[model samples]
Target: MTAVVSNSTEYLLGQSLSSRDDDNHNIYTNLLYLDTSSPGFNDPITFPKDPKERENLLELPGNRKVLIAQPAVVTDVGDNIRHYTLDCHGFQYVNHTTKCSKEMFLDETMIKASYYPEVDQLIKDVTGASYVHLFDYAARGPLNGDDGDPKINRPVKSVHCDQSYEGAKRVVMSRLPDKAFAEEVVENRRFQIMNIWRPLEPIYKDPFAVTDARSIPDSDLVALPVIAGDYTEESWAAEPNSAHRWYFKFAQKPDEVLMFKCFDLVRKRMSPVEYFMLRLRTGLKSICPHDKALRSELVWFTVNSSSNQIHDRYL
Candidate 1:
């Protein structure tokens, strides 16, 4: 994707990337990429399960910053972005309006009761899956020290995919009550682990960006270990590549939904890893005069076309 550079000005951290013409189609920003210069850098970095320990390692010097030019996503091209399927581009955008109230996002009980069903139906509609199970959801906000809510987490800054194929299988087994059924599904049934992301309010900072899966090669993927208590899981992180093409919806609204595939059992030709990174790109400086934080929410759904009755133990 080629971007028309309207201005030659350089951008620093926390600065605006918009041009003077107010181009809504592209933004230049810095994104974190894995640093492969260190010896044995591909070796898994163990992240402690404890939040305090994890926070200490958040700013580890293992990552390198790269200036990335992400084009604004054009939703009106053809079929309302349906051409960019999970199988093709690893991500899709849909103009879906939700019935859940904003207050429902604040409480876990309300989120499970109201928002979960909404997400389930949305996933079923988009994927045409016989069954859609929402496993987890996270409400993320800016890195404010005094939020006081444990449910709200700081937005992730690095370029990474959520799960690896083996990690996804473990998640399936952990969520299913019947061990036999879980094994069967993992071995035979084709499934996908997808993330549905939406902004709770209009996005002005920290815009979410995803790279076209076709642009990424398998050689760039590096498996990183995540230690959670007694269990450990692997996720994919990528080294910087010049061929990568990034896209994001400028000033994404609450009604817009970005659905991306994290792991797809059927699309084995292309790697199941879906690559994405979020950057703190300040929107049009004139409109966003005040530097307020941004808030968004994401839900993970396990989708399958199976009609079999398997008991699910939601985690």
Candidate 2:
């Protein structure tokens, strides 16, 4: 753990007025639902992968109306995962079992790492997960200041949860395919959208911030429609509430992973960017704030375990 640098973006929890161009660079505090009938939506969203595109990545044409605000208390969170998120649900952090090799990120042998089994074993050791699936692996870089390069994915600075209830159900159905198996899995197994997120290098500027789910009531979550590539997914946007609590372990390192729940079976269960560093009121910060790029790798998959066991022996 090196010295961590801290920064803040004024996120917009309420709706004012924004434009399509501000989508990637700006995060809206208000919940903006999807209007798929809008023009060019059916058209392929292909474009030159340039600075402008990355900055406005979240932008889409749609009809959205602002909703009422919710009430709550806001608290600053500590770096301990077990205290804030794991036992609390929604998110958790843990130390890696071994040293990190940067080469694994670039090889892209479909993410064929020698220690992959070891990694899964580590995940099982912590979560008591019987089936740990590695579905996707991606590398994200940090906010690219003038010196920032576009080739790398940036460390997301936006405050948002990745999945909605509908999206989770859709994923389960697509993965399982068999109605009987899917139903049985959904009925008997514990499902979680878990991500093993860690920086490939040391993080100081713009460390990841995860809001405590317990602090947020269901009313504050808005289901916003997001269209990327060929798919449209519904994602939850946290409407800025004064009571929303935010936590982060500053200067996050390569040997540590943020195992977070984008959506879990427990509301019953549920589910960045800078201005290219701020645009929204509750998540606002700057247009560009870095002179270099940040490297990070996140491998996420849903795990199903018939039994819930805590493997704290190694810890």
TM-score of each candidate?
0.73, 0.64
Candidate 2 lDDT, 163-206, residue by residue in tens: 56665555565555467866664554556655566666655444
Looking at model 1, how many pairs of residues clash? 1
- Residue 35, candidate 1: Cα error in Å is 1.0
Q: Which stretches of candidate 1 lie over 4 Å from their true place?
A: 1-14, 17-23, 39-83, 143-148, 267-296, 301-315
lDDT of 1 by residue, 60-143 (tens): 443222324322322222223445555567677777777876666768888888888887777776676876767777776553
Estimate the TM-score for candidate 1.
0.73
Stretch of 10 with least lDDT, candidate 2: 277-286
> What are the runs in model 2 whose C-alpha is more than 4 Å off?
1-82, 98-100, 145-151, 176-180, 266-299, 302-314
Tell me how far candidate 1 lies from the true structure as C-alpha RMSD in angstroms.
Answer: 8.8
